[model samples]
Target: MTRHQTSNNRAVLRTAAVPARKTLGGGGAAFLAALLLLSCSNPSGPKRNEAKIQGVVYRNDTRTPVPGATIVLERPVSVATAGEGGSYSMAFTADTTYITNVIATMPGFRSDTEQVVVVPQKTSTVDLYLRADTSSPVTPSQSGDAANIYLVDFTPEFISVSGTGANDVAKLTFQVRDAHGTPVDSAHGVTVAFSITNGPSRGEYIFPSSAPTDPRTGKVTVSLNAGTKSGVVQILATAQVGTKMIGSEPVRMTIFGGLPDQAHFSIAPQMYNFPGLDWLNRTDQIMVLVGDKYSNPVQPRTAVYFETAGGVVDASGYTDAAGLAGVTLRSGNPIGNDPVYGPGFAYLKARTVGENGATVKDSILILFSGFPTEMTLSPSSFNLPVGDQAGEVFTYRIADRFGHPMAEGAAVNVTSDGAPVVLSGDVNLEFPDTQSSSWTTFHFKVNRKESDPGAKSGNVAINIKVTGQNGNRSISLTGYVAY
Candidate 1:
């Protein structure tokens, strides 16, 4: 029997239509209202000073701790970082009343906030459950026992309609289900049809649009050609189930045309040093934002072209749903007079053709600040007699991120431990000191006569450290001397 017939027979056999439905719906509404009100209301009696706050943050669906979430407390504001187990704690002083407000936040997850009353010498715990952001255009799930079909999702929600036919296709995916709200695997081999419900007549679902659902998944895929015109296209899906046909409610997608209204551009870690010895592992990211005149993010997967000078970049790509596109740029070798140990610049440009065939463009100047990243000893190992003055133990070198020697005169401090080896020269020596002309080296000697012979037979550790003028980075080198 059809679903409607089954419902009718049940209704007539029992009293389920008027009184039962109305009574249950009314009770449910009232209960939900009360619950919501109670949750939003604050407690009235609160006067305690020695209270403690602690809680764990969990993913709403998985019930697992959300490590790295940040929790903040108001009123003499304080913050704490959640531990690996997603637990955090904060203490409030005794003798002061506090209606503490607690908030927890993490990127890509909805933040949770709550207010609790603190009583003297008591512990108030508040556990937070965070929901993942589901702000995408497509969401799929069954509601009730209904024989309905719908577009679960259509990838690339927006399309840039160029005059060419090859660039106008969008993939449309949908599902078929039975009246019981379960995917109808039996519906496999059943043909599903696609059509553009709202768009210029030029738009069409490509041939073979009437394809059978997959035998295992009850899903179907088809291609729709967005017409040359720019506007919103509503794609609809339908399939026949049993003797009756079910139609999927239509979903809307967009096609862009005309001059783009806006463009945004930025570079990640705008300041970085060129990776001299390690180019493959270091890179900067460039992000571009393209939008229509209305400032709405452009269509997903809209191709954008990138051009850069003074760097290497993976520049060709498309913008995502948020109208954002990203490319990685690795700093090229420092050129000309730009110091490899100082600041340098690279230029990047992003451009995309709007529907009107006009170029929408933006550019950014990526600044790279170079700093010393490595310290090395010409002779890494050293050995000394227990009672002798050693000369020029080893030449220490300082290099920037690009492996280029820093300017001469960089000052460094040396220290020794375990076996007090007396530094024979100045404690602070200029890099590549007067003894050598190299811009990055320093030579120093050690007098080990004062080293206590009983201490591991006068084994000593010599340490050399240097800090740049800007304090952006500090580099240190350690060498061990053994008798």
Candidate 2:
């Protein structure tokens, strides 16, 4: 009876407070009320800070640190490079990840690249192993020490072969013998691939030398039965390194197709060859047409592959459509007439193609005999600044009696005031005036001796000589100076 009376009294109190009370709804109301109680009792905790990351890079093969190697943190953000102990340290926030690259670079050692990742507050370790570098120099790139490996029925030096068309197959064979020319059972280790450039594509067209090894005679077949460029090309065996340079000897073969089309172009007799036209003097408007058997007009962007073991080509063109497509030919015209190249045996090749992109004309072959062309500097003179060394500016052009820009990268012999300098230098430079596909003009920064503070100015002469395969140079020059 007392408990019932007390509950009735509480109900009376609730009814009395209803006029002054409001309601709070949902779990949010419960949370807010709890928060209020807590605020009256306890305080909130402190905030957390961002995380930090760090690490080191080492040599994988030797288990040693590879110092001086280039390292990159290639992720959320990048940090790089290890100091002297082959050790590196870097920092990052907790939530981010990073990629690290390590490159190996040491002489007589091969190079390599590696990757890694790092998370916040965590340290990552990445390392690398670099092998020694071993490759031949087709260009002026740095190469390692090498012993010669001579093969039979193959040219170790660059050679050329002709192809039927874009898809034509070209073949050549090399013997896998010892340095003494004795065939060895060595074909098993050969890995051959072709470096295809300047063709329809612009990278390696590899043909692995991994052919079936002969158990008996130890003879390996070095053949390029596929991926031969239609024009003149320098094909060589590219060897990969890990062990000795001795296995699977590298061989070179120059493959070419078609005969050179006999071509002739005209220039106003005075532009270059006027009464005093010195050799290598460029003409203004090379106004001659190329002679090919095709009834169709010469394709504007055809593969007019022009090259010279002798000199460079200048294709500074007037037309915007084709990037200056120039070639340097052997300067002299010792070339005689042949069925392939009617008169100019300058080894020029011209081909016609159908809509299907197939060779429409037979590859023409040009055979030029006799001493090659001469390269001479025009005005053969100059007055250079006393303090500031000025370059030698000259006008040079290539023609086959008729005129045209020679192929590209021609060998030109240049002399200072009559003294010999570089044998082969500079190719077709951009011409000066009218935007015609005619003659090319260029300024050669006349290399000068460090100007002596004592002498104010001096008179000198320069000669521009054209070179040939045999190292012979055709010389011409002008008044030179050093200020």
Candidate 3:
């Protein structure tokens, strides 16, 4: 039984090799043997050798052709792509390491790559698997975002990359395309942006070296440095007919690192707390920590300031020379009793001087993670008309942070030291309109505690105490009421 299984497996393997069949001729045997060795051998092994790779490009799954698909071949060392018909073949220099890129990508479908494949044959047939675009009436941005990238001309439809030297200048050529990828007479204006990473500045944006215009053929040059760090960096080009950005594309490149080193600032502790790690009250110490890359204390002249949207806390502090300085923010109002933590974040900016008095900017943001404690006091004054009996009405309202009638709420704690005053039962609160976020108002009839309407008017203080998500607040009103 074992021998039978082995024999069946051998038969299946040979059948799968049908596509690997060699063409007839005198060197057929030797050629087939060599081809197998090339495809099967690993370039990293001791038996490494240069090999030529070539393949026809086709739309994935379907037999449709992708004409002029730029085939770029690149590695740690050599670099190349493809041209027309979605095909690319290049030689990987013997000194090169890793797989050289043999990529085929169209506008609508995903890209496919054939990397360093050791092969003995003069040519290789590696079919790509590209997904098709099954969408309708979508813009290019949307089309590419979804799995559906539109199929584009293998060679750029309108322009080609022109110029030379990724270090000083490189040219890009293209025919103009409208919002739709259709070739237009020209783009009104074109600009390309460049930046160098791991150099003087990481992601330092610069304007285009050469401007482009509407023409059958357009060309724009890009300037780069020879010593830029060898890594993937972005190059963006924008073409504007007028004020609108018509079409933009990004190109990626890798260059050697050998320029001015760039550095950035940092936020200390990553979190700035007003009353950090402790209770927020008059008895606590409130301080802000300003940190940067050096982690050393900043000077008072650094010009640091803090601002919050809620305006509950006052940020007035300076970093000592050691980068560790603290300032205590004083809170005396109702905020101290029940504070509103945060419905937002706060901004902290630090400015200082570099060489030649040049200005340096460092900004940081801290999120409000904790709840606020809001405590309010209420009751603005209220009055009742003459002859207002137990059934009559007297109205009063609660106040907010500002001394104004905020809204309506039921119940009021009436108190007087001298007079044995009396009030009515069954008080009702009304909310015809709410002026403030939180307000309590009610109307009540005072009982005939002192039924001397003809007597002199009396004075009393009215107050309403309420509590909610924030904290406790009270409204108090002092005014004279006719008896």
| Candidate number with greatest TM-score | 1
- Clashes per prediction? 6, 70, 61
On lDDT, the stronger of 1 and 3 is: 1
**Candidate 1 deviation (Cα RMSD):** 25.9
Off by more than 4 A, model 1: 1-259, 262-281, 333-343, 367-483
Q: Please, what are the lDDT tens digits per residue for candidate 1 over residues 32-119? A: 3564466447343455454567777765543446777777665434567788768898875545544655667666566666665555
The pairs that clash in candidate 1 are: 48-120, 49-94, 49-95, 257-355, 258-356, 432-441
RMSD to the true structure for each prediction, in A, is 25.9, 31.4, 19.4
Candidate 2, run of 10 with poorest lDDT = 10-19
lDDT of each residue in 198-294, candidate 2, tens digit only: 3423122435544533333333455444222322344454434346544334333333322223332111111221111123422222222222222
- Assess candidate 1 and give its TM-score to the true structure: 0.31
Question: Where is model 3 more than 4 Å wrong at Cα?
Answer: 1-54, 57-463, 468-470, 473-483
Error of 3 at 39 (Å): 12
